[model samples]
Target: MIKFENVYKEYGNGVRALLNINLEIPEGDFVFLVGSSGAGKSSMIKLLIREEEVTRGRILIDDIDITKISKYSVPKLRRNISVVFQDFRLLPKKTVFENISYALEIVGASRKEINRKVDRALELVNLQDKKKAHLDELSGGESQRVAIARAIVNKPPILACDEPTGNLDENTAREIMHSLLKINDAGTTVIMATHAVNIVNELKKHVVTLKDGAIVSNIEKGGYYCELD
Candidate 1:
């Protein structure tokens, strides 16, 4: 559902963050992006989300050329994709239900539809009981789940997560990963960027490794082979 052909991204001061990145993620597939710090994982995501413009080459999502999508149409393009981040990024003052519902509201979903979707999403993440809770009241894992629920509330065709389990304990991380897998099973294309090698190795999913802003390896049913001390 996503493809990048010879993609290159350079910041305003000519710092190249990605180079010749060619990738294809089929619909409903779950893939892991593995890399150390400053290896262009974030850069790839920024390009995908249109947070930064590509310096060269093309990006296609479900056959639509995203690189050429007008600024006015970018919102429409983004409506089909959802992103979760390491920090959760929840509004501090909003309740769990409000946080998830806010996304639908921004998209102009009706009250009844927003309520239904928010509840369904919270259920998916096993957070229905905490719907009225504020972000500060939840544990780190619970907060992360709330972020995931918010991301999927719209039922986006694709989901990209950047280090979703980065800050949690191993067990909690596993739970978060399980939640992501459930989402993947339901047919959303899932791409996760993480440095957690154990999870990637155990899952035996497709893995793309990046180093120095370039793809060092792309393996189907791959393991984490980067040497560690």
Candidate 2:
């Protein structure tokens, strides 16, 4: 389980990005973090991935307090939690297989293991046909699928996505969501931050709404319209 206890985040510029956040996300659950711009959604993601530090309180992943871990252990911690960004941040020149397998390579997995894991990840994202294709050769949705495959190649227990469908059209965005849902079905905890109302309403998943850096509402099977009254 992931737990946030009295979490707070404040920048040096005197901006309070988050205030007294306390949340729990159980294993294999799919959650949507919904909010308007600057609502501290991104700040929460940064804190989860340890890109930023909390000003106060603690964050625990399965009883491990991430807020107090040493800098050297951050990379190891990330192996259990992977992130997919809006930009898709892929190597344009690399083949889909190469891109997804790079994560395993960083940890020095043998070629046999890389191939096995890459194959499984590609299947999970329904991108097996595009394994040999380069990034420029795939459509926007396909590229995002590749990014998802890369994020899950290591079999991380948690996947955090920030504005994953923000760059695609409505149909393409739905396709990307389908892939994400598939990953969630396979038992990975999925936490997504998005502004897509239609998608939120259509899926009717867990929604946590934020306003001015504070959680205003948390609804089971919630829609985008469920913000604080």
Candidate 3:
């Protein structure tokens, strides 16, 4: 379980990105953090990965207070949590399989383990046929799926996506959402921060709406509640 207790975040520039956030997310749950731009969604994601520290309060992941952990332990803590970004940061020259397998290689995974895990990740994203394809050969949706595959190859307990479908058209965006839903169904906690109102409304997943750096509501099977602009 992930719990945010009275969490507050203020940037060095004196911008209060989050204010008194208190949230609980159980294991294997799919949640949509819905909000307009600058609503503190990115701040929460940064805190989750320890890229930024909280100004006040504790963030407990399965009972460990991440805020108090030493800098040396941050890398180990990240093994349990993975993040996917909107840009689909991948190696343009690497094949799909190579991009996904590279994650395990850096950790010294054996060739057999890398092959097995990469195969599973490809299967999860339904891109088995594209394993040998390069970045230039894939569509936007496929590239995002490759990013998703890379994020999940380690089988992290939590997957946080920051505007994952932001770069795709409506149809392609839904395809990306479906791929994410498959990952969620396989028991990984999915926290997707998105502005795709149509997808949010159609999926009817848990919606945690934020406004001005504060949580306005967290509804079960809810749709988008914030204004578009």
User: Per-candidate TM vs. native?
Assistant: 0.96, 0.97, 0.98
Query: Looking at candidate 2, what is the lDDT of residue 85?
Result: 96
Q: Candidate 1 on 112-145: residue-level lDDT in tens? A: 9999999889878888899999888899999999
Q: How accurate is candidate 3 locally (lDDT)?
A: 0.94
Residues 1-229 of candidate 3: C-alpha lDDT, one tens digit per residue: 9999999999889889999999999999999998999998989999999999999999999999999999999999888999999999999999999999999999999999999999999999899999999999999999999999999999999999999999899999988888899999999999999999999989899999988889998898899994644
Worst 10 residues of 3 by lDDT: 220-229
Residue pairs in candidate 3 whose N, alpha carbon or C atoms collide under 3 angstroms: none
**Ranked by lDDT, top first:** 3, 2, 1
| Candidate 2 residue-wise lDDT, 40-100, digit = tens | 9999999999999999999999999999999999999899999999999998889999999
Clashes of each: 0, 0, 0
Model 1, C-alpha of 180: deviation from truth (Å): 0.6
lDDT, residue 141, model 2: 90
Q: So what's the TM-score on candidate 3?
A: 0.98
Task: Name the runs in model 2 displaced over 4 angstroms.
Answer: 226-229
